[model samples]
Target: MRRLPLAILAIALLVAGCDDAGASPAAQGSTAPAASAGGACQLLDFGMVNAKLGLDLSVAAGASLDNTFTCVLQAKGVSYPDLVLAVSSTTIDADVFGDMIQPKNATAVQGLGVAGYQMPTPAAGKAGPGVEVGWLAGNKRIIELSLRFAPGTPDQRAADAVPKVVELAKLIDLSSL
Candidate 1:
């Protein structure tokens, strides 16, 4: 039985090797099936500190059937004065996803603020920096990307991540999604 399994594994490896040799150069270079419009938005490395977040790309329902990509990042135990690198485009916008982030050291809650449908406060906990990119869909269905790291203080990380995120966002091609 052991010998039979070994033989099967060997055969499988040989078949996989043959398939690779038959694949075209384009097939190896491009992972996606077809070319997308927005181009390709590559995910770069961003060093953040104790950060957690989500990236989602989905097809919008109704009307034109647009595609949207949202990136959210949150971190704890961050110091003061942070920077964030984010992506930028007319269709891309960055903002506080939920309620204002009341760090460990908060003075007071002055006033209420507008809330988004996907992000409601109270249960939402403290708000984190978020970037959203969207565009009309053509050949692609969805494109999602994210980068997380423990850079340091929240303020500093946010500031640094902003520009980087914007640059990254511009690289994203909605047509591929």
Candidate 2:
């Protein structure tokens, strides 16, 4: 339809602008650290995301392609509240994640993964009101979490940020991706 989510957000902003070349320490403004042990942002922690999405981020950046691995958390000299976690070890199913990564009217999350969904943030720029949660884990790898806020947050906080992005997507483990 709409050019497939704008061609998957233009190949995720051209693979996050080919990462490293962008000098990702949160892209030079500095602040990307944390996320070490087993990388890929260690499926997020940072004090359980500021005690459940009350966010203080404290930066953490990452990027990869050929098997996907993206982690970004923010808030150290501002850049709107941010939290993005992506993982993909290939192996997709459930009709290719409901016809290529769900999204169009998403809202089916029922037990974390093996096929789940959630939506919002289709527009709201300046990092206000957002929420997203995707799944397909049971080893079929494919996660995607999102949370944005900061810019007069409180539009019911994007429906209260959807169960806090399904409780951080049920503390994502998926064989410790």
Name the top TM-score candidate.
2
Q: Write the per-residue lDDT of candidate 1 for residues 1-177, one digit (tens) a residue.
A: 111232223323322232212221122223342112121212221221122222221111011111222222222222111112112222212232222222222222111111111111111122244322222222322222223333332544444554444344343332133
Clash pairs (backbone) in predicted model 2:
none
Model 1, position 60, has a per-residue lDDT of 11
Q: CA lDDT of each candidate? A: 0.25, 0.64
**How badly does each model clash, as a count of residue pairs?**
47, 0
The TM-score, computed over Cα atoms with residue i paired to residue i, of candidate 2 is 0.34
- Cα RMSD (angstroms) for every candidate in the order listed: 18.0, 14.2
> Number of the top candidate by lDDT?
2
Ten-residue region with minimum lDDT total, candidate 2:
19-28
